[model samples]
Target: MAGQGSGGNVIAAICNIFFPGLGQLVQGRILAALIFAILFFGGAALWFLIVPAIIAGIVYIWAIIDAAKYKGP
Candidate 1:
């Protein structure tokens, strides 16, 4: 709410740590939340494959960083 590095962003980042895209949802970014959730969870669901698992891990980290650095539009 107060741009990147704000307390809200920190909290959002922490939320994303627990659940990918949850931070976006908390920030009222429905589309972003859906996109990240789908990407991360979908990839996670296919974790039997090495590539998908790696992709999901990357997505999970990216989601945290995205939430932390997001500046509201």
Candidate 2:
């Protein structure tokens, strides 16, 4: 994928808006994708606790930013 600020990053960010970690998957970041997916989903699963729901929201936003700002090595 292209470096940060590229079209790919924009698309990735948009993808992440729909589902956490999807952007990373699109970028071929399997590990990051798995981690984000797990963290977000896990937190979301505990929504009844409130705190976990907040954490999930944070994770979701972070995933979008991470994907958008990712600079390929």
Candidate 3:
């Protein structure tokens, strides 16, 4: 249903906003989620700025799109 799709999109957006890979985790994409989390957080640590946030924003949009496209569990 559209509602379910939207809900997933919201969750994905939230996850991507707070931390990369979170959306994937919610989607049961454990490996991908972990990879994204490490890469994003690691980059933040190395850069010492908001670069990760910017990257996360992009990823968040991607996640939302993916969530909207989700067809099943």
Candidate 4:
């Protein structure tokens, strides 16, 4: 269980890193994913600073938590 959760978290983190909210989508959090995607991408387009990257990192952490708690397909 721990391994599975950790793996899911890693995947979610990676997905979120590449495409914000993608990890949430994978975990069945479609609305949240869409929102994050819009905000993340929009921010990236508007501001190319370290802030977006930091936000991505924070989202990735959230993804890890979500992944750890996920129990569905």
Top lDDT hit: 2
Per-model C-alpha lDDT, please?
0.95, 0.96, 0.65, 0.66
Candidate 2 lDDT tens digits, 1-73 = 7699999999999999999999999999999999999999999999999999999999999999999999998
List the lowest-lDDT window of 10 residues for candidate 4: 1-10
lDDT of 1 by residue, 1-73 (tens): 9999999999999999999999999999999999999999999999999898899999999999999999999
How far is 11's C-alpha from truth in model 2 (Å)?
0.5
What TM-score do all the candidates reach, one by one?
Answer: 0.96, 0.96, 0.59, 0.57
In model 3, the worst 10-residue window by lDDT is: 64-73
RMSD of each: 0.6, 0.7, 3.8, 4.1
Consecutive 10-residue window with the lowest summed lDDT within model 2? 1-10
Give the clashing residue pairs of candidate 2, or none: none
Choose the strongest candidate by TM-score: 1
Candidate 4 error regions (>4 Å) = 1-4, 48-73
Top-down lDDT ranking: 2, 1, 4, 3
